[model samples]
Target: MKPKYITLIIITFGLLLGISLLGKNQVSLQGNKELPPSQRKLWSDSSHRQIYPRTIQLIPQIQATKPWKIVFVSKDGLKGHQFHHPGNCRNSSWCSIWENAKQFGDSAGVKIELAYVHQNCAGIDECISTQVRLIDDLIAQDNIDGMIVGPRDSNLLVPVIEKAISNKIPVVIIDTPLNTTKTLTQVLVSDRKLGEEIGNWVVQQLKGEGKVLIINGPKNQYNASERKKGILSGLQTGNITILDIEETDWTKPEAKAIAKKWLKQFSDIDAIITVSGNLALGVLEEIKAQKREGILITSFDNYPEVKNAIVTGDISTTADSGLNSQGSLAVKVLVEYLENNQSFPSIVYAPKLELLTAEQLIQFHGSQKSKVKNQK
Candidate 1:
């Protein structure tokens, strides 16, 4: 045979062999008849199945646009968040949030709107309804990018918050932590520590031996409950006996009624601790009415009344959880997340606790100028 002819025959045979091997490896109907039964069965098994390298598709990053619109939902009504503080608009927690959000938005070229639960919250039910409606409406809007909600009740706001999360909207909770991690973040003061601070202060004042009373806020509220827990934990160290504990809605009338009943019932309340200054004032009125003097009163939220009380020896000491600072930081966190793609902490605690008393009145007076400077 010629050399070229031999090479051609060899190449043809090699091609034919390769094709036959490929057919046996596959279970295609067209080639199955060429393979043995056992070979066909093995080819159909998953071990012989087709395979490819796994791949992940990366999403393109979006540049944050200017004027990112945001909505702030406050548990309290718009008017309620406005306080008649002595020097600054910083007195109202909700108002402070609104103000700080606006300032942050202006600086960051973001737009913010404040929404309240209800102007007239006849009851807790109405408050919840109004808040739900407001938030749902805001979420439905196409222009809004995110939400900052200060929930009135931790549990009541869970559903709406989940709805926001489902819609891919980021939520930052302030003041009170809702019982959900679905939120982007929470801005809070250490409620338990604040409570413990007050409790420990009371114990020290009474020299670790006295009958103390707790005028607590709403029993179901997480912040209020945490404060109560902290107080109990702090009081655990001393010989102080908790005479009685009452849950109020942080309302003046309800606190007064509870105080009246307590005064009539217990003759030995060495000190009274209230979760809010408003409640403390209510209790103070009843005490005055009963002519009960020299009873140490400690309260939370250094409101104007509480400040005056501290100065005049009416309220021994009060805790101010840096309301304005909490509000300012909440907005700042949301802005950083939206603009810079920065991840927010699961829970962002606000600045440290501040104890307000008559001695700090001079420093408090100086705060007004700085507060005004920052607002500008």
Candidate 2:
């Protein structure tokens, strides 16, 4: 064969072999005349089934985009993954925010890193120290450009949030306030309104005339104060007797102990209610122990025990801060800022609180009961 002709033949054979290997097509056995894929005894043993295409087809008019990285920091820990927290239920204030971020990230092909925050929420100096250290480290790392946070984190996370604001990392506060910080722009969910909701419910349930005990949060917390004010305002309507009120420090055991101690003193709390779950559980423990079945206990938060209590008639009511909505909103807000390159208010309140009762438990979404019922 002429050298040129030989070379052309070799090239043609190579190209045909390449095409066959790359495309999904049948190969025949020596004499059986059966399709290579169909005759295969096992899928794993087949070599002629198909091959990956080496060339990628690219559209000439489209441009590649960069992925946006969004970071969410909160003292409430990661939603749905925290050991004791109800992330799946969006129990954390930012659960909705994270959900929104996740969806938007997915849609825009962005990446998000949500940080489980730990800050001194007790208003204690030493605990605040550790929280400050961690938040400072994150800020100094300059790893993420944007942040969404709940400034009034337990104890005194507000101050730590100040450090974040100082670094000019745009942040949004939920369920708390940066009241003292001038750097904060906006806030979410008026805790005061939530308190008012509790009080209003109490007034209606008790005909605005029963004696009620108020369990509250730590002294300086903005949300705590607002909740107290709301409850007080709502209860001021008519013959509602102002019963003995105590501070639970928003701690479950503490609230329980306080309830026990106070119940002994008052002896006639027609209604025992708290704005925090910790306080609510405490009230439940005290009443159950003392065999006081007449006292109706109302509470807040999506704590499991709280939910169970409502389910079994152990407690009168429970409320959800619309976790999914809040989380989704936070993400929506953050994405807006990212896309617009504009400054946002320091706080973004998602005050959509749902009143939960035995009659309305399903409406408030007992996340578990609903799932079980759906499975059927």
Candidate 3:
């Protein structure tokens, strides 16, 4: 063959080889030709099945638009009696979340709206139904640019969240985790870790041996269940005996009633662990009313009354899981993703758990006052 013709034939053969390899590498979604073992394995893997496409195609439009509306769906509404503190708006977690979300949204130049389940729900089932209805209404409105949800039940909220995603609305789960991975991001505290810390604190206070009681939140809630598990795991390492495990609606009256019964039944209860600050306050009030003594109390959350109890030496200690920041962070994350196409991890944990005691609370406030004085 001529030298030029020989070179041309070589190039044509190389192109054919490249095309053959490319065909083998591609995996077709619709066609059912037998794939190579490696490609077939990917389809059979469970982890691969969980992968979801990013359906939020409205980022560019949201970024180009001004004053996008974002809604925060809270688990419960603001109620003064719930907190038992003078300033309900300042102390309630629901209010804190709304205020922080609104502040952040305002700063980001987005409009923030808050919707919450009615507190008078007959039961957990009713409350969850209310939440589902609220989310569906928001999604159907078709005006919201983004959504941040503090889900009441992890599994029940999955369908609505997935629906929102399919509708091209980015959803960010806050406070409690959602069961589905279709969310844009999750900003929350590690409830299990916080519970473990509380357990550890109780063990240390009791010197590795004592009888304790647990006042837990609702059985079906994710945070409540995880925290209870963590508390149990932490207590297992020590010679601790759990006197009783009681579930509450995260309410003061129910917890107080439980505590009253326990105070009457058990005289040697060494410590009490509550899933929330409000519950702790309820237990504390009952203990005081009965003139009980020497019972150490530990709790979760950053309620104002919890802090006051720490300052007054009424309770042993409590964990601050950064409840104050979860809402703000969720709003911030969603807004950043909308405006800048920023990608974040599936779970964005708030600051680490801070165990608060009387001394620590006093010192923290003193330092704050000093900083203000210095600034002046």
Candidate 4:
């Protein structure tokens, strides 16, 4: 029921921390055993999994010797968009996508141009307008061969996407889901399935009978809606009663504020289900500040804050969408189509969801540290 604009101030100032949740404490690592060999192989800062899916047929050798020009449009500027840049000892899926795309593009002799929407530059509406204008300009150019974009708003960019398609350009959509299925390709995890996983985890933790609250993403966004639906479907088999659901802009303060109010008003809330770790961190802060205990929580995204929260017993569980694999694979698909005239499937699954608990977080961090030490 919270309006989107109410939290804009908090979100504009890097409050979301790149979809990262916050924790009050850090848990120490005590184990000497490195992450399992398989897990170590998959935990790269870029490309969570290096192995590509085996189903796609082999792409033909490149016929074009000239470098193809491709453009990538992201939701926000480089720093604000945490996906592409790896800082703070964390490598995000977006970073992996960009890194992989660049690496593959260089080997294939292609150029990848980055266009940041700068959504926060002026405001959401103005940022969108800028993106539209940029897309239009890019489309008008004669030599621009392809585009990869994730729109800020799902429906707002449909017309521009239509224009690109009409221009005979191949568009590979990544991250956010769009309404039209007409795009050349889409790269994202199954939102509904991820939501169901969270819901099922909650049901199991609570033993299927308790009042629950949900903190979801923006309204009507494909990913947000699908996750909401999945959570509801998963909870259907249980005796859980939904107390309320709030639509968030994926900011921490807004989520924390909402969670605080709900916690004060509803004493029977046994668990919290959030779509992103940003909201989960906010909610957890409220629970921690109030000294509330035994309320289970779950969310998506494996941001360090969320990982630490798991270790400190603030979050019950979380899921990772394998951003690294998704980014690299998307680029590979785009390059294959561009260079070899090979077409990719309409929908491709990057990798299965990697679910984690507190113990797993600790072990994962240990393995990362060990890997880093050996490299040094």
Name the candidate that leads on TM-score.
3
Winning model by lDDT:
3
TM-score of each: 0.74, 0.68, 0.79, 0.75
lDDT per residue, candidate 3, 26-71, as tens digits? 4232133433443332111010011111211112212324677889
Give me the overall lDDT of model 1.
0.72
RMSD per candidate (Å) reads: 18.3, 18.8, 10.0, 18.7
The deviation in Å at residue 339 for candidate 1 is 1.2
Which residues of candidate 3, in runs, are more than 4 Å off?
A: 1-65, 78-91
| lDDT (10s digit) by residue, model 4, range 1-376 | 3667767866775766643433211111112223333333232334132433423433322324667788877654544454434354242334435555555567667787777654454445666678787788788886678888867777788899889989988888887776787787777778888888778877887888888999988777677788899899889878999999999776778899998999889988898889877788899999999999889888887756677788888898887766545655566677778766776556665556757898776776688789999999
lDDT order of candidates, best first? 3, 1, 4, 2
Worst-scoring 10-residue span by lDDT in model 1 = 44-53
Residue 19 lDDT in candidate 1:
94
What lDDT score belongs to each candidate, Candidate 1 first? 0.72, 0.59, 0.76, 0.71
Q: After superposition, how far is residue 102 of candidate 2 from its true place, in Å?
A: 5.6
lDDT at position 217, candidate 4: 81
> Which segments of model 1 are wrong by more than 4 Å?
1-65, 82-92, 366-376
Write the residue-wise lDDT of candidate 2 on 1-376 in tens digits: 8999999999999999999876543222212133344333321101112221011111212211546566665545322235433235323324444554455556655576766544334433443455456677778877675665654344466565667767777665555555544432343565667777877788898875888888887676667778789889878765788767776456677888888787788866788878766578777887888887788888877545667788788889865654434444555455555665544433444333566777665544556567779999
TM-score of 2: 0.68
lDDT at position 304, candidate 2: 56
Candidate achieving higher lDDT, 1 or 2: 1
